[model samples]
Target chain A: MSLKRVGNQTVVFAKPPVILSSYSIVGPKEGQGPLGKTFDKVWKDALNGEKSWEVAESKMLQEAMNGAINQASVPKEQIDFMLAGDLLNQIISSNFAARQMALPFIGLYGACSTMALGIAVGSMLIDGGFAQKVLVGVSSHHDTAERQYRLPTEQGAQRAMSAQWTVTGAGSVLLGSDGAGPRVTSATIGRVIDFAVKDVNNMGAAMAPAVADTILNHFHDRQLRPVDYNLIASGDLGAVGLALACELLKQSGMNMGTNFTDCGVMIYDESQDTHSGASGCGCSSVVLAGDILQRIKAGKLKRVMLVGSGALHSPTSALQGESIPGIGHAVVIEG
Target chain B: MADQTQKKPLLSVTAEKYQTLIKQYTPKPTIIKNVVRAFIVGGIICSIGQIFINLFSSFGLARVEASTAATATMIFLGALLTGLGVYDEIGKFGGAGSIVPVTGFANSIVAPAMEFKREGYVMGVGAKLFTVAGPVLVYGITTSIVVGFVYFLLH
Candidate 1:
């Protein structure tokens, strides 16, 4: 058997890329969430003094990139590549941020699964001897995503009870061939799964199956059980998706038990009135950089599996009466 | 519709079965609570419009003029509240109550304008000004014209 290729879809990195540093910045609403204090910086307002919400999102991503580089004590000149993505069309947030950084840019679009996708690609690059250091970043804004995906910011339309609030946040992780932080040990790339879910509001339900698929595949590939990892966190399944995912996993004879929790459900309190919970590309990214990495650094946790689920649907496609297709990618971080 | 049903077989048996499984977990909307809130909020808004009409009539305006002025006042209030970012909250609580009123019409026009203002004046605000309310106006006008043509033939 090849050293890096584990089971069917998993890639066990031979020389695992160490996460040198991670940084997260969130808007005021996210700053008030449960993992609020863990974030490195929080803007008082969503706009962050920008003219538009799109610009504000790009600024957050740029700041996070700079923050991660600075925290790692790595000079900007030494970074080999910048890999990033966001929810905006053409990934404008990452593109705009990359313009200013002037680094070797590789813009990705895995929607909400961007964090895991970025880490997987970045780790592969470092381990393959393609690059020494890679910066992976992602950002999403509530106002920006709302206008793009649903309705205008000030529109008075009532949202469905299953709807999730888009998180306004950005996170960056600096990965290197050698470092002293949590190492990305493996990744499981997911398949695009579609169950013909037509409801645009209930994204959690649409993404739940993909989340279940990736998580199940990860466990099978690694030859491990739920107890093997300190935690198994899904990207942004929210409440409905998380419950559905648990049921699906149980049916498959792989119960996640207490170690399973969703980042979407963990980000907000019940009183937040976010219906299902928080979602977006930023949802998992901020949770990972702000909460998960911090816990790993402090020796409070050891191994973690981050399964990021993404609803790969567009406004145009939905309007054309197409069902939402979901994708998920898994990354294993071990301290 | 026929084409769509014919394409249903493209979905695997597992995909079709999974759809049924997920429906059990999805929460249904509270119909009774929404209906109650809509009724109460809608009644309150009409009452406020009535108060404005009474006030305008007391100032010696004709009954029709007073009613027209009250509607204008409501639209003005809606636009103002929308600008201040308060109408969305009311719309959230009131549901169709706030939406069925004249103020809701005003909001439909102003909301898109504000959202797209970043793209500049002509292509953004002017083009998208009637985006939300356009269909309502189209159907309303088309139905009125049809009614008028039928009335003309009968007369």
Candidate 2:
């Protein structure tokens, strides 16, 4: 009932309700290309041959949720809640995924930031003693995202350098009352900040305001500078957005260059030619699920500010001549 | 018997609707299962393609030409299958499997106009322009600006 209920405890009575345990996923950590080609491959692997982006995405979500549950050795029936979402309107991936898992659910839509948002809340539920076991998951498929959000790659259409490689993969974590893993220590929910750039398709610019807002919140709430974080990362800001974040951070009086980083800019290898870098829900998850969590588990990373960002634009909104809606969430995980 | 068959509507009509009418009915037509099939099929297709690429090398086809041929084959296969409606069936089943590749992108653009032709040119052909490509152009530019700016700052 009071703010004291959610204190900033590093060792907080904080049972994640369940251990983040282990995560499993499929992605293109090996090679990269144009966003569309990469996404096609992601869907190709994720959906197999499913032509429909929505269909493959739904299935990929199911696979990701299954990975969390199966890896945790938790049965579907035992789980109390499942929180998930994607970039699609109505979050078709999360919605359809919920259908397959047949678990109680909450559909989230924080863009690439969906994973961190779900993780932050799920961990809080465990920390707050609300639920004994919670499963938080998020995913995206390149093809599904492409059809829903952008071009079908075959047209050989050119993408701006700021465009991010929408990763085609799935990620999920099982959170519960176990304290053996990286504890969810503190979470700062970012309020929406608009830069007033209304070009709906141009999400990097649209989301900059939200990214700046959350990074500032993370610093303000923690009362610390960027040096405090071993790494301060943003979701799918890509190349342009990531650079913009640095400048924005400076304007906010915090220099994160010594530590600040971004998932979107990091996911791709140099070959990708990804102008901005990586975007979409799968970007953060793949990085987290693939290596970041492992490093944390190994005591390699002490503190990390993981933020996910998304452009909140609808197919019709872009058509209606409205600016993109941008939202971001920051989750601070400390060892 | 004929009238009864006509009245029944195959019950499968529900399958094509993308939504369910019955409240208590369970969610079926799992996309996950279909995705798995698509992966298997698409992988096989890719592997076969690789084999062709290798064969072309052995047979003296240059890399560029071989790659182009491979892409051409995929496009031809894509267009032909799309024309036959088989791609749509795959689209319904695997969703992304058939759609995620260069082929899926192909379908996103072409499928609409084919459906639209019945309505005449402006609505059909013109309408198809934005159906799939719109997201690409818009996100494409915005993402490019972000990427370019990032490169500018980071570099």
Candidate 3:
């Protein structure tokens, strides 16, 4: 109960909640990536047996949550809360999956940053003694996201170099008050920063400023240097946003060094033809659940900072010539 | 145009400023490559149509009937390719070349319908079947009717 608030936008947990278990389900493309073997399940079919891509996303989340909960050895009713989100309009994938799961759901919409946002909130709930166990989930389907946010897959529109392909996958993490695993140690909530960037295709460019802002704030609030963490990961800046964020950070006299990387750039191989790289809510979610957590358990990484960034522009707003606003939330996970 | 310019100097200034800023980041289209791809694809599609027309005419059909049969055959091929998920690939490679043809019209109708087929037969497939191609059909039919009416009146 002692002061958890730190600096302007950070919260340091007095008692870090343990991540009991994590599960990730990815599509064929992601399954073909470097960390493909680490995922609990990879659907070879993009549709994943569902009739539509949206429904396929819902099913992916449902299966991910079920798998994570089962892996954690916790029954569904025992889990106190379920926090989840997706990129679809009204976040229908999460809502529909929650309906099927029948858990007490707190639906969220952080665009691509939903994973980190959910984990941060879940950590707070458990640390605050309001919940003994919490489930955090996030998902994004490339087709569904394209249909809602951009052009349909049917359109076959040529993507610009800065455009990122949304990752088709889902990931779930189960956090508990008492568990023997990596712990959620702190969180930094990001502010919405818009520098009047109105291009919908160049989301990495739109979100880079916000990532830099949150990372700087998180570092200052936590009084930690970049060398303190084994690795620092961004949500979905890809090639373009990562460079911009690093430049911005360098301007602030902070250097992340060789430890810095982005989930978007890591999830897809360059030959995959993802213009910038893999993006979406599922990018960081599955990466954290599958790659980061596994590495931590294997004694390779002791500390990691995951900064999830999201563009908050809607299609309607973009069409109306409104600038794209972006957010980034940071979570510190320690082994 | 002169009166508007005289009345709205501030509007012009703002428009110019916005235009300059947008131009900096706007992606430059590869015009030559696109034009060449479009021309080649369009020519190939038209040549196929011509072959179909010649074939039908050699079977003793009239010229108009042969042309109509060729158009129907092209549309049928387009719809079949769309169903088999090949038209999208062609469209991806050919860009406007594929889209400017009657086959592309068939593709536009079938693509969304196939995508929405999972929602249900009536509300999903049937309704969305025309979502993409609806405007073209409406305007094309309407303009043809207008032209027909005008020709009749003149006669």
Candidate 4:
């Protein structure tokens, strides 16, 4: 019944919050990837002079957050809130970064979907007149993630062919109520979908259904088809997940066509030897912050939908033989 | 709660159907290729160990002592390679070949120790040194104990 509430699970902002500026900083590996030149800064080393990979990850997040804020030319004190998250236990990267930023921090834990979730929440804060400007950021590191989720960094275990390389990067976006940039017009918060995928290596397969569900909901709610957007990018669905998602969407009578692509697949090249593709919280965030927004600003892309997909399963849960639950959050950005 | 119970079975059915669809897209692991690579690499490693055994034997050590010294040497090499960050790449290429050897056992122990060393010596390396090798040791010793008991009863 509300004007903002759309068909089912979407919110159409009355006053869309504009993405004032965004900054992406990636490790050496990602900097060598296809979208390498698009990132704002590329660290020469993954450690970036930090003693530990965990510390490096937090530092990268801080650098990205500061870079975004500085690019927006907004005073630090004027920013209403900081929404940040990362692929780490207790979201230590974001929490540690927030400690230095000294802002009203809200640590999120949406795994890979943190970027879209943060943008959706930030837009709502602005559109609802609760905040003037908000900073949203997400980070993930390959070494740190591997240590926490899978095995030790130097462990000699052959990676599964379906396994994705966790992207070592951080991306931050600055949102303002009034700005001269692309606006976040609508959002579709997705339901957690578990297709009983137990293998952590096959994250793409685990997350495909969730992406399709969220995209379908977004289209239904917005009364817009796939053709309406110049690009509809899913977060970190990699090659396997993207293919499954396309097939699933087609079965639902929603043909995505050529306009649909995935951030994971786009980030790395086939020659990179990243079996499936790039993944992690940073995967979508960096792609969106670096490539997507830049294209929007350059007039190459108009309306875009970023559907961040996340495989929600802990190592403990996976060890317990529980199926991996997947989630996808959709944020529609219009130029 | 009532709604959840009613929807659970239906949800599971859909999930099952979706999994079948997922299988069509997921690529099968290259088992044959991996096995072949493993065989070649594992053979080369064992040959190197045999060479080490022969070298140690020429030094007047007994056959048993020579074999033991070769194993220790191989383990030391594995740990050294792991420290130098080369063993993981070898493991990647060799698959089970690199892992089935005594050197791989050393790698399993040394890798975690190196990774966790940052958390500090006492809690980090000391606690996690055997994280990957712990299961192997646990089951190996347990099975040996059981086998020993069986042998004693038979004797």
RMSD of 4: 3.2
DockQ of each: 0.32, 0.02, 0.11, 0.43
Specify the highest-DockQ model's number. 4
- Write model 3 residue lDDT over A1-335, tens digit each, in one string: 35688777888888999999999999999999888998999998988676779889999999999999999899888999999999988999999999999989999999999999999999999999899999999999998987677654675345677788899999999999997999999999989877567878888878877888898888777678999999999999888788777866775678779999999999998888787787999999999999999999998999999999999999999989998998999999999
Per-residue lDDT for B1-155 in model 4, tens only? 01222211112126777878877788899999999999998999999999999999999999999999999999999999999999999999999999999989999999999999999999999999998999999999999999999999999
**What's the C-alpha lDDT at position B26 in model 3?**
40
lDDT of each: 0.92, 0.65, 0.87, 0.93
Output the better candidate (3/4) by DockQ: 4
Candidate 3 clashing pairs, residues 3+ apart or interchain: none
In terms of docking quality, model 4 is acceptable
Worst-scoring 10-residue span by lDDT in model 4 chain A: A1-10
Clashing pairs in 4: none
Native contacts recovered, each model: 0.47, 0.01, 0.10, 0.54
Off-target runs (Cα >4 Å) in candidate 1 are A1-3, B1-13
Candidate 3 has a DockQ of 0.11
Q: Which tens-of-lDDT digit does each residue in B1-155 have in candidate 3?
A: 01222221011113234334334444456678888998998899999999999999999999999999999999999989888878888887788899989999888888887777777999988877786788889999999999999999999
lDDT digits (tens) for residues A1-335 of candidate 4: 34687766788898899999999999999999999999999999999899999999999999999999999999999999999999999999999999999999999999999999999999999999899999999999999999999999898889998999999999999999996999999999999998889999999999998999988878876678999999999999999999989988888778899999999999999989999998999999999999999999999999999999999999999999999999999999998
Chain B TM-score for the candidates in order:
0.87, 0.63, 0.82, 0.90
Worst 10 residues of 2 chain A by lDDT: A4-13
**What ordering of candidates by TM-score runs from best to worst?**
4, 1, 3, 2
